[model samples]
Target: MRIVIALGGNAMLQRGQPLEAAIQRENIRKAAEVIARVAKDHEVILTHGNGPQVGLLALQNAAYDKVSPYPLDVLGAETAGMIGYMMEQELYNQMPGAQIATMVTQTLVDNNDPAFQDPTKFVGPVYGKEEAEALAAEKNWSIKADGEYFRRVVPSPLPKSIIEVEMVKKLSEMGALVICSGGGGVPVRKLEDGKLEGVEAVVDKDLTAALLAEQMGADALVIMTDVAAVCVNFGQPDQKKIHKASVQGIGELDFPAGSMGPKIDSCAQFVEKGGRFAAIGSLYDVEKIVTGEAGTWITNEVEGISFYEKKEEAAVA
Candidate 1:
């Protein structure tokens, strides 16, 4: 089966860890192992998030007093290339003689998207409340509380189309393990003159991955992340893992917009558009996720065992 796997940012680097090249590469190596395993059986296309990476670049650029900070578009491209390079190299080491290609993809977004007005995407490292407030004031940045620490937020527009999807599909069909759409394809917009221009916004990677799956006619989308499964009332006593669910059932649980919500919504969108299945689970368990042994599976069909139902059955027995 042809599969598209979207790697979450947290999967690439843990929160609060120092931004170091060696550390990030080690993390990529681990992720690459799992990806290489899946690629052995299926034609695989990879996409990944770069929120923390891009934001760190922006912060570094701000320190240069002679020139203005680079726009998000340029930073986004840099991240795609940087992250793609590491991922490609590591995957190659794991699966020697396999054809792997990393394309710097472009994703088109609406210039007038409401997301521009409300920047809610978090980026960069976390900071103490006081430090976050100070930076927000100095940089004119939008700040939001992320768990125990605060981070910067930016507009996250929805991706309308993958600009280089045709070529990506061609590569995938030819048996190449392709990686594209880093940081949601660099977030571009169409101009009145029929030219594409970069925009100052972030695009959600998970949504773009779903779009890629739909366009490529992939059988399933596997979202590899830090968590093992999608849960209801996460972090509470009543929290229940959702082993399998229909699109409508996943919607009833309120996932945080900054985190799991996009993954759930993306899976639902894929299934709604006639894709066979979507799974979200720990990156370490990619095999199980693909085989439906682990993780949260979302489908249009409502018949199947759910985690909650299994718990009830065990209780009765």
Candidate 2:
């Protein structure tokens, strides 16, 4: 089956880990092993998040007084190239002789998207509220709460189309495990002359992945995150894992704007648009997720929503 897997940023950098090359590659090496296993039996198109990577570049650029900091579009492209290179190399190492291609894709967004007025996407490393505020003040950045900590935020416009859709699709048809649309494909908008210009915002990768998957006519759209399943009342004592859900049923729940919200919304959109499967779960267990052994599966095949029993609850029963 053709599958589009959107790898969350945390899969590589993880929370609280230093953004070092060795560390990122090591994490990717492990990820490649998992992906290699799945690729052996299916056609896979990969997309990845760049929340931490781009933020680190922005920070580094700010530190250098040589010139003005690079634009988010440029930073996003650099991250796509850098991260794509790493991922491709690792995948090649894991699956010798396997075909793989990574492209610096461009995603089209509205020049006047309301998201420009509302900076909601979180980027950069997490920091305490005080530290985030200090950085925001010094850097003239927008800051917002990311769970308990805070981080920089920028406009996250919705993707309207992919500029390189035909090429990406062609590559996939040729049996390559293609990686494109990193950090939402370097957000851009069309000019009056039909030319495209880069935008200052970041497009959410999950949304782009969904759009890509739909356009590619893939059978499944899988969002691989750090969590085992989508949870309701997250981080609370009564939190429950969603084991299965219908597109409409799962779309009604709430999730954090910067984190799980896009994942849930993207998956729902895919399944609602006639996709056979949409899932959310840990990247390490992607094989199980695709096979229905684990994670929260969202589809029209289910009647409604169902929750996984807590270990204690199941044991007692």
Highest lDDT model number: 2
Q: What is residue 271's positional error in candidate 1, in angstroms? A: 0.5
Tell me the alpha-carbon RMSD of every candidate.
2.8, 2.2
Clash totals for all models, in order? Answer: 0, 0
Write down the TM-score for model 2: 0.96
| Total backbone collisions, model 2 | 0
Per residue, candidate 2 scores C-alpha lDDT tens digits across 71-143 of 9999999999999999999999999998899999999999889999999998999999899989898888999
TM-score of each: 0.95, 0.96
Deviation (Å) of 287 in candidate 1: 0.3
Name every residue pair that clashes in candidate 1: none
- The TM-score of candidate 1 is 0.95
In model 2, state the lDDT of residue 240: 85
